[model samples]
Target: MDRRRVIIDTDTAGDDTQALVLAALSDRIEVEGLTIVAGNVEFDHEVENAKYTLGLAGKADEVPVHEGIRSPLQKEYETAEYVHGEGGLGGELFPDTGIESADAHAVDYIVETARENPGEVTLVCIGPLTNVAMACKREPDLDELLDEVWVMGGNVNCLGNVTPAAEYNFWVDPDAANVVLRELSTTIVDWGVTVRDSTFGPDTLGRIEDAAEDSEFAAFYDTITQQVRAFNREEMGEDATTQPDSLVVACLIEPDLIEESGEYHVDVDEREGMTRGYTLVDETGVLDEPANARVVESIDAEGFRRLFLDAVIHGDPERSLA
Candidate 1:
């Protein structure tokens, strides 16, 4: 099987860290590079956090991390420190390994990488869409090179996490999100209803940790569990946490785990005050044009968890957590 080449644009939140781990450990996905944006934390912190995360995943040398935009094109960046904590990894600290940084700008990196592997690169964005949008603006021909863009933003049929109508990723940078949703030919894993319906709670986390105990990926899984527990205690006031990015990662590694509906014309609300960054879908079938994106509506939770565990374990039944 030909592995899918991918470039991840993220903010290194706890959830984003989990997604990185999944991508690094998966054989089906070849991570071309990582671009850090300003969301979940500041741009510098996000870049450092991406390095730390890839180091933790034991792929720091294989992936080049680049720092992208410091703020949105229009609105000021807002972070969910309450959920991701001060350090953006649930306050967990790791020693800096001083990895070499990317020499080129993130936009340039995205364009160059896509140009090198035309129609084979998949842009998996799990945070604010600033970098991808800016890259598209800088290189208008990127649309022809990209095979697909899997974005983890927008709320199609569910309530928003930031505002009553907007999801956190889009709400942080509505202008950037709007640019990507409108200009790029991509697929959006809608947060509105898809995420809420496909949650990985305590049972799944415990299974993952248990499975990790016998694999070389044990340490990675353990670290992720600790962060998840902290996030749960701080945000949900419980010992179990539900990870959103984990779901996105699962979708990437195993697209069959997610059941999708028909394609739809999705738009982001950029108006000020109310409904900013909300993803409004034309569900009535009144639009004359064809749908630009294949929107994911639901996922098979059990299958997704199994794939996640398999990716972590990688058939090493004797993997030791220690």
Candidate 2:
């Protein structure tokens, strides 16, 4: 099988770091580049954090990290420092490496790369949809050129993380999210409910820690473990953090892991109200145009976790977390 070429748009939050590690380790998914957007942290901070996380995963030299939009299209950039901590990973620190720049702006790179390889590049976005939205505006035909876009956002029939009707990523940039959900051919991962159902409880964290003792991903695993614990205790008052973005990576590597997906017309509410940034899914199937996305409602949690663990621990010797 041919390797899947992908460009990841992220903010390098704790969970985003896990997804990045998994992608770097996967032999089946070739990460063409990384675009740092402002969501989990400030724009500059996220860029630096992305670089640091890549360095920690031993992929700094291989991946080109780009600075994306600093704020949303029509709203101020919101951050979740309370949940992700100051540095977006519970204050986890990595060695200082020289600041490497992206070869081009994220929007330009997305358009150019996708156009160059029509139907061969997949854009995996795990943060606010700012950069991808900009790309759509710049190229307008990007949706037709790419293979597919996998997004870890929105809530179809479940409670949201930021507000009762909004997930954090969508809440931060509803306008941008709206653009991608409506204009782009997307595969939506309803993390709101799926993540809660596929929780990485204490047992999973313990298993990872125990495995790390003998694996090459020890330091990276240890850092992720600490952040997971902190997110659990500080945010959920629980014992583990739900590996949401890691699940997104799993969807890319093992699409069959999620057996059920429904066609839906998703709309994001951008108006200021109790329902701001809420993703409204038309489950009644009353739309006219071709459904732009397949919203994931369920997942095989064990299969996904195993895939993630294997990817992080054994997939790539050069980028091992040991």
Give the top-scoring candidate (lDDT). Answer: 2
Evaluate residue 21 in candidate 2 and report its C-alpha lDDT on the 0 to 100 scale: 82
Candidate 2 lDDT, tens digit per residue, 108-193?
Answer: 89999988999999999999999999999998889899999999998887889888888888898999998898779788887664
For model 2, the run of ten residues with the poorest summed lDDT: 313-322
Please provide, for model 1 over 1-322, each residue's C-alpha lDDT reduced to its tens digit, 9 standing for 90 to 100.
6787899999887778767878887767788899988888756767888898788678888999987888888887578766666677666665666887888888889988888889989999999998999998988888888998988888887788787898888888888887887778887776753455556666766776786767645455566457557766776676765556767767776677777666888778877778888887887778766677777777876676666566566732112211
Residue 132, model 2: lDDT of: 94
> What is the TM-score of candidate 2?
0.92
Scored against the true structure, residue 83 in model 2 reaches a CA lDDT of: 73
Give the deviation of candidate 1 from the true structure as CA RMSD: 3.6
Using all chains and alpha carbons, the TM-scores for the candidates as numbered come to 0.89, 0.92
- Can you give the lDDT of residue 258 in candidate 1? 70
- Model 2 stretches astray by more than 4 angstroms: 216-218, 225-228, 286-290, 315-322
